[model samples]
Target: MKAASYDAYAPDNSRLRVGDVPDPRVGPGQVLVEVRAAGVNPVDWKVMAGGLDPIVEAVFPVIPGWDVAGVVAAVGVDTPEFEPGDEVISYARMPIIRHGTFAELVAVPAEFLARRPVALDWAAAGGLPLTGLTALRLLNRLEVTAGDVLLVYGAAGGVGSIAVQLGRERGARVIGTASPRNHDFVRGLGAEPVAYGEGQADRVRDLAPGGVTAVADCVGGQLDTTLAVLAFGGRHASIADPSVTEHGGSSVWTRPDGAALTELAALADQGVLTVEVSRTFPLEEVAAAFDASRTGHTRGKIILTP
Candidate 1:
């Protein structure tokens, strides 16, 4: 099977290569997905550069992807939940980074697989899992609810865009932070947009003078702005910054839950949620895709179709 792999931790992505790797083998309680599309994430590149070396060990020649949407080519023994031809999507991260989604095939635990939303095309579906799940978890952690004013940092990017919509769906008044160029885009996601950087807190105050009741920081380094605009006794959480914990906010991480993803899929089908895919690359162009992800300015997801 063809895959994109790295021989070692190379910050420049110089070791990245595309070639045939051994086909992933299915094990009991797992399903083999014939890859259709994979999502490129910042963590994918970070892992490639050994940024996560202390936490997660990587085998050399590691295939570099975690989000996938594809069809079940085969089911492992004892995997009664899925059969061949079932379309599915998953956050396919393993404790050990070896087999991954940036390949012709990947083996996923059955508990981590959810039926792909029919409302989304391959690229959108592929991009939905990780970011969507992260957004859901953050909102849940902050206990966002009707009558609460929610502020989402990085509102035009993958996780933030979904967080904006989900906050709106939960009946919160959402305020999102983005660049001047993305203000309209963020507004279209049902949030009032405030440009990030200097004076961002003032801008948010102008929108919600009572102060925001919740903050979901998708992009890090906004602890000051978040603290400034937060209402008295308000909740805050950050996926990118663990330092938030020291300031009375939670540092959040997403868990792989097929049930939660199934609910998100239903939201997509009901027109309450949508994924924005900025661009896509072929399997062989994984390097270019990673470079695009590193730009930190893309409006939505960069995907790879295998």
Candidate 2:
């Protein structure tokens, strides 16, 4: 099979290249998926540059991608949850980096697989898992409720955009921070938009005079800003900043859960959630996809069509 792979970590993505690789071997409780599309995330390039080295051990000639949407081609022993031809989406992060979804095929543990939402196309389904999981986990940690006023920093990025919509679904009044150009885009996702940076706290205070009931910081480096506008005793969580723990907020890290993904899929099917794909690249163009994601300006997801 042809896959985009690298033998060593390179910050400039100089080692990432497409070439033929052996097919993955399905293990017990796993399924082999024919990759239709994969999502490119910041972690993909970060992993390439050894940013996750302490946490994820990388095997040489690593195929680097975790978000995948595809059809099940075969199932391993004892994997009864899915069968051939079933469409699935998975946050296929392994404890170690080795076989990945950027390839033409990948072997995924059944525990990480969820049926793709009927309403989503291939690229959108591929893009939904990681960001959706991040947003869902953050909201869950914050314990956002219908009556809460939730403020989201970096509201136009992948996780933040989804968080905005999910907050609205839970009946929270959401105020999202984005650049002026993206305010309309964020508003369309059901949040009142506020421009990020200088005086952001004041803008948020104007909208929620008493302060917001919860905060989800998808963008890092805003811990002080978050504290300034948070209601007394309100909950807050950050995906990017671990310093949140020192400020009475939790640092959220998403875990792969088939059940949670299923629920998110149902929301998509019900028209309560949607994924925006900002760009699509062929598998061979994975480098370019990473470049685009590094720009940090994309409003949604960058997809790689395999």
Candidate 3:
């Protein structure tokens, strides 16, 4: 099996290389996916540099990726939920990082696999899992509902874009923060766009004078602005900033749930949700893909095809 792997930690892409590795073994309650596309995320490189050291330990020569869309090649015992040739997508993060989606094949737990949405191509499906799940979790935690005013930070980025759409679908008036260049893009996602930075709080106040009912922070380090703009008794959560907890906000993290992924797929098939793919790279160009993700300016997803 060919994969992009690194022997040890390096903050940059200097250690990433494409090469042949031993094939993964299918264990009970697992399924083997023939990799078609893998999504590049900030966490991939961050994990390579020991960003998740305190939470999840990495094994040496790690293959870096979590989001995958592909066809099942085989199924392990007790895994009647999937069969060979079934197209699937998964946020395949495990406690250990030895095996990953950035390979010719990855063995994912059966509970992590969901049928891919018919509406999305391989690239879009590949990019949907992690970010979509993150947004879904954030919105769920915030209890966003009809008549609510929701503010999403980093609205044009992968998770933020999905959050904006989901918020709108739930009948909330969504206000999204992005750069001037992405204001139109954010608006297209069904959110009012406000440029983030100095005076961002004032800008959001102009849209929702009573303060937003909910805040979902996809980009971090804006706790002060979030506090300033959130309505009294409002709910708030941050995926990147834990300091939000001290200010009566929650720190949220995404988890793998095949059932939730299936619901997301249904939304896509119904034309209520869609993924935006910014770029696609070949397996050999993993380094370049990571470089693009590091820019932190991508409007949507950066994907890698195997």
Task: Name the best candidate (by lDDT).
Answer: 3
TM-score of 2: 0.99
TM-score to native of every candidate shown: 0.99, 0.99, 0.99
Each model's lDDT comes to: 0.94, 0.94, 0.95
- Which residue ranges in model 3 land beyond 4 Å of their true spot? none
The order of the candidates by lDDT, greatest first, is 3, 1, 2
Which window of 10 residues has the lowest lDDT sum in candidate 1? 55-64
Q: What tens digits encode model 1's per-residue C-alpha lDDT throughout 32-140?
A: 9999999998999989889889988888889989999999999989999999999999999998988889999999999999999999999999999999999999999
Model 2 ranges off by over 4 Å: none
lDDT at position 129, candidate 1:
95
| C-alpha-based local distance difference test score of model 2 | 0.94
| Candidate 3 local lDDT, 40-117, one digit each (tens) | 989899999999988898898899999999999999989999999999999999989889999999999999989999
Q: What C-alpha lDDT, on a 0 to 100 scale, does residue 47 get in candidate 1?
A: 91
Candidate 1 Cα misplacement greater than 4 A, ranges: none
Give the clash count for each candidate: 0, 0, 0
